[model samples]
Target: MTVRMFMGDARVDAIAPDDRGLAYGESLFETMRIHRGDIPWWDAHMARLTHGTQRLAMPLPDATRMYAEAMALLDGADGVLKLQLTRGGGVRGYAANSDAAPFWMLSMHPLPNRIDSLDTIWCEITLASQPRLAGLKHGNRLEQILAANEVRAANADEGLMCDGAGRVIAATSANFFALIDGHWQTPVLDACGVAGVMREWVLAQVDAHVTSLKPSDVECADAVFLCNAVRGILPVQRLGARAWPRTHPEIRALQAALAQSHPGFEPLLEAS
Candidate 1:
């Protein structure tokens, strides 16, 4: 992994001990796919990051400078890049530090191994319906952490989560999509769940309906898949006792379309 820390535009040694992001989870982040030292979906990621900062009332780092630094760190590698933006250091309370300079960091990591299919489980953890924080990649993630731990303990590749009302939302780290009645459907994120960049792409490609889904609806679907920017599209092989084919024709088509649109996902089609 390669990392570079920054405060505003100046290089920094480390995060401050009093950083609000460290102390109070007042931050936002975007994880991107790097292809030949460049992020294919950089604009979409930045748009989401900007939305997050606006919602949290936090300052965002300059995008052009941040891009330059990230490219410098990547150095023509095909990998993963994570950009984290924080509220910077603050005093000992929850009040906003209006004068603090925002702190940000860019880190590069090796791409994960290609996933042909996923074995998933229905997690017991449920997401709270906090409309204010919904659909933003905010820093508070205890719910996701616990859900991921459940999946790891069960030896599953991913875990499906739901809101308190029993409406299936998404996976621990990716968005969920189900094919039923010859149409693609995904859960509405107006209440909870991150509006993943890959999910948005898939929605545009398929014209998928943003609707509510129950576990029964998912288990009865003809096909199921999960998606994120890093791993592309992943077919669901098994969830609990219900099982489907490791690859579906519709999923393959979507992957092919993604490959055509983004160079980073082109390799995933070959792996599939």
Candidate 2:
């Protein structure tokens, strides 16, 4: 995979070995989809990135230069773009010095093959409550990595994670939503989970509610689905012993709504 490294105003071929982000996961990243050479939600992604940098007290590289480099790297191809920003090189401790220059990287990868439906599993790796980093998409992703491993073991497409108290949080790499009693409901990310970009769009496009949901609530819902910026929206066909009918109206409506908003998801609606 080809990667372009950025440190302050200069670009390099590779990341420094002693970077803090590499040592302690002290970084933030955003995975975005490029369609016809344009990143539809670039502004939103950058807004979240800036928010994360501010919260972490980390410096941000030049946005204009970063955008230029990213676009140049895209080269008019439609694919996934990942931006990783680290706290640069640091002397071996948790005590942040605040003076270190930030190191950032931009890499482009092939998009995952499109699937009509996703089979999800309820993971056993419970999310610990951490309000300080609740909504930001930080690099401390061991929980998600573990949950995804469980998903692979279960032969499922993705894993649904819950808090230590058993309240549903999110999918391993996406946010979850379910239809219950004709209403769209999703778990609140107040105490855990990443607030996904596609999730924010869905909340605006549909009449969705954020509430604390139990595992049984998801299992007994009228229909269930997951959403992420990269893959758009996905319908869940099965979760554990429970299976949902493919033609659930709520699911179809959500897919249609997504298609109307983003042409990239139109293929998904057709496949569904």
All-Cα superposition RMSD per candidate? 1.5, 1.4
Stretches of candidate 1 off by over 4 Å are 267-272
Q: Residues 8-28, candidate 1, lDDT per residue (tens digit)?
A: 988999989988999999999
User: TM-score: which candidate is best?
Assistant: 1
1-272: candidate 2 lDDT, tens digit per residue: 76899888888777788899989999999999988777888888999999999988889998998898888888777789999999998888897765877999999998889997889889999999999999999999999999999999988899899999999999999998988988899999989999999999889978888999999999999888899999988889898889985747767777787777777676444443
Best-performing candidate as measured by lDDT:
1
Number of colliding residue pairs in each model: 0, 0
